[model samples]
Target chain A: MIEVEGVERRYDGVAVLSEVTLSLPKGGLTAIIGPNGAGKSTLLSVMGRLQKPDAGRVTLEGMHLAQAPGRAVAKKLAMLRQDNHTAARLTVRDLVAFGRYPHCRGNPGPEDQAQIDRALAILGLEPLADRFLDQLSGGQRQRAHIAMVLAQDTGCILLDEPLNNLDISHAVRIITLVREAAQALGKTVVVVLHDINMAAAHCDRIVVMKGGRILRHGTPAELMQADFLSAVYETPISVHELAGRLVAVY
Target chain B: MSPEIRARQITHRMALLALLALLAAAAFLLLNARGSWDFLLPFRGRKLAALAVVAVAIALSTVVFQTVTQNRILTPAIMGFDALYVLIQTGLVFGLGAGRVSALDARLVFGLELGAMVVFALLLFRWMFGPAARNLHLLMLVGIVLGTLFRSIAGFLQRIIDPDSFTVLQDRLFASFNAVDPGLLTLSALIVAGLALILWRLVPELDVLALGREAAVGLGVPQERLVLGLLVIVTLLVALSTALVGPVTFLGLLVANLAYLLLPTGRHAVLLPAAALIALITLIGGQALLERVLHYDTALAVVVEFAGGLVFILLVIRGVAR
Candidate 1:
């Protein structure tokens, strides 16, 4: 479980995240949905320990993220930010193998290699394992990044804007992989998503944010009402049940 | 390429570089030699050692710096190291005049330059990366600004100083291998060896750092501490090399890029040595060619800067086109 209490982050005297508190459940797919500048990514960044909060504390599984050893925290939590880039040219296999650095410290044993192979197999990246990241398409590179995250073998995974720039087919494929990781592997997965229908159909819970504050947090069934979403977005949005699933339209 | 094939190919390339470096060293020592064996061996050997030290220092520093900054077109020199060296030499001439500056002990002058540079680099970087970890782009901007400021000040000093003193300063600043201070060469070699040892231990972390700050931090590599340590190492190595020979601006840019292009992988273990060997070959072989074959009177730094500057332009254009 991740506990965030009174977390506030400011930039140049302006608060990007204001007195926000949230508790992320241990094992499920949780999607943070908000419009641009709504602090969705910032909240996720704080929870993942990518950015420190100015006012409060965050703990992952009873261990303070700010005080714990980086290696220990890494073994428990894995965070992947959007638009990953590297100066070094790395192959898919090489990139995934780096996920084991915290454990193996560059000398991967047989077990570490097995984890790498499993990640590649899970993401269907074995075919492209030898290809460099720059040689791959946008979707393929995103998959490669996810594969690396999976190779980390952390209990909790946080991804920021994983679906950005991906096509519908690719996006669905990635969401399915994320869902499967949560379900089959029992990992706590938090994803920041732009597509509401995809989140409604796939995620177990949804957290809505507006103006850097949490507007609502509940199961998709409880939070997918038209009035609440319309108010959260400050625009008219309609929700309809389509074949047993709630779909939102604007 | 498959891992096995790629590993073999890399090994083969490394072997070729080593062989070429050896050939260059031999040719540098043996070409057009007619003095007594005793005098020839020690004199040529000292020069060879000095060149090799500078080559290693510059190449290693450049590659490590580029990896930290995640930039292909940048070198440590862009942080105004070379400009600072010029400023130091010009300042000495301006303040003390040419004759007195020349009469001062060469080792004392070298010590002064090296100390001032290292101190300046630390202060500037501390201010940038101190209270909070400032972003690298801001750090780069400050470095460029300070570099331009140093250049302008040096230019002002040069304009006012007498022509004879100005000529003396120019000779001191131009990067001539023919005038390496022998007393300081041994000291530089020792310092470089120590710095290389520290860098070698951080190779694995550096490989992770190439993934950029977020990924590095996520993977349990303490990004702030590691980057700060690497920057200090870079400052020391750049200071050592620049004090030994005046600034050889483009050699690091040329050799590091060549290492990346030649080697098919990104592992720093392989890349660092490849860059060093290439630098060694460039300096030694280019010196031999100019001295023996063409009978050229120009410093080897001139030829290197010409080639390196072209490579820099090509790299920039290619990046933009891409």
Candidate 2:
């Protein structure tokens, strides 16, 4: 389990995340939904240890994340940020191979190579494995990054807006793959998402954040209501039942 | 672009670079062999060794510095390293008096300058690369400002000093490849060898570091500590080369970018050696041409800097720096 306790993060004098606290158990896909500037990404980064919290502490399975050894934390958890800019010109295979750094420390053995191959195959990137990242489309680049995270093979994965720049089919494929990882591999996956319908359709739980605070968090059936979303988003949003699944429209 | 093919390409490129570097070294040492072997070997060999040391130092330091800073166009010289060298020289003349400074052992003076530079670089990096000030643009702005300030202060000290002291200062400041200190050359070779060992252990992490701070941290690198160590190595190298041949501002930028262009991979193991060889070829090859072909009409540093400046502009115009 991951626990965030009274965490506060500020930028300049403004509070980006104020007194945010949450608990995530060991398995399942949890989707965090919020508007722009709602601090969803900030929260995810804090949990991933990419950014330090101004106050409070975060822990994974009784170990304080900030104080734990980096490799230990990396082996247990992995993160993928929104912007994936790199100065080095790396091929898809090269980028994915880096995910095994915590495992092999730059010298990949046969097992590490097998893991790399598996990651590439799962992401459908085998054909583009040797192609430079700059030669790929935005959606393909996004997939390459995702493949790197998957290659990490951690117990927990934190993805901040992973669906960005992805087309509908690819996005669905990724979400489904993520769900499979959560259900089959029993890994805890946390994703900050923008599309509410996608979140309702796939995620086991929903965390609704607004103005740097969690407005509500529960199963889809509990939180997917017209008035609750309308107030949370400050816009008229209607949640309708399409067939047997809930579909959100605004 | 299969993996096998890509690996072969890198190996072939490395072999080609090694061959060119060897050719340049041969041309430098054997182009005009009029003297006896005993006289020519030690005499020309000292200069060649000095050039090779400076080339390796500049190449490794600049490539590592760019990897850590994640900026292609910035070099240690542009960040005020040589300016600080001038500042220290001027301060010594102004404080201890020119007679005392020149009377001091040359090795002692080199040690003092190198120690002060490393200390100052550490402090600057700590201040500018703090958690809140991690923006590359901001760091570049600070470096430029600090560089100008150092130059201005050095200029002020130079103006106030007596004519005799000013002359002494000029001798120290004028960096010529034609006159490298033999004693300093030996010390520099030892230092570069030691730093290369440390850098060798860091090559793997360096490739990951090129991915940026956030990504590196996410991938389990101790970002702050590693960056400080890399900065220390960079400071030592820039100081060593500057103390030996003064400073070649754009040589690092020119050669480092060239290595990146020549090599297909971002692996520092390959990139580091490639940059060093390219620097070696540029310095020795240019020196040989200036002496043999050009008949010593111009300093090699001047011609190299001019070419480097043009490359800098071309890189900017090509929009590759970002």
Q: Please, what are the lDDT tens digits per residue for candidate 1 over residues B1-322? A: 8988998999999999999999999998999988798998888898899889999999999999999889988999988998899999999999999999999998998899899999998987788778665777887888899999999999999999999999999889877777778878888999899999898888889999999888888888888888989989999999999988889878888999888877878899999999999999888887777777767777787767765567667866876686
| A1-250 per-residue lDDT for model 1 (tens digits) | 8888999999888999998999987889999999889999888888877788999999998999878888788898998788687769899999999999889888899999999999999878999999999899888888888888889999999999888778888788889988998999889999999889989999999999878888889999999999988987789999999999999999
Candidate 2: residue pairs that collide: none
Those runs of model 1 whose alpha carbons end farther than 4 Å from true positions after fitting are: A167-169, B131-133, B307-322
Write down the C-alpha DockQ for each prediction.
Answer: 0.75, 0.85
State every prediction's TM-score relative to the real structure.
Answer: 0.95, 0.95
lDDT of 2 by residue, B79-172 (tens): 6888888998899999999999988887887888888888878777888777667676776777789889999999999999999999999988
Clash count, one per candidate: 0, 0
Which ten residues in a row are the worst by lDDT in model 1 chain B? Answer: B303-312
Model 2 TM-score (2 dp)? 0.95
TM-score for chain A, prediction 2: 0.99
Question: How many clashing pairs does model 1 include?
Answer: 0
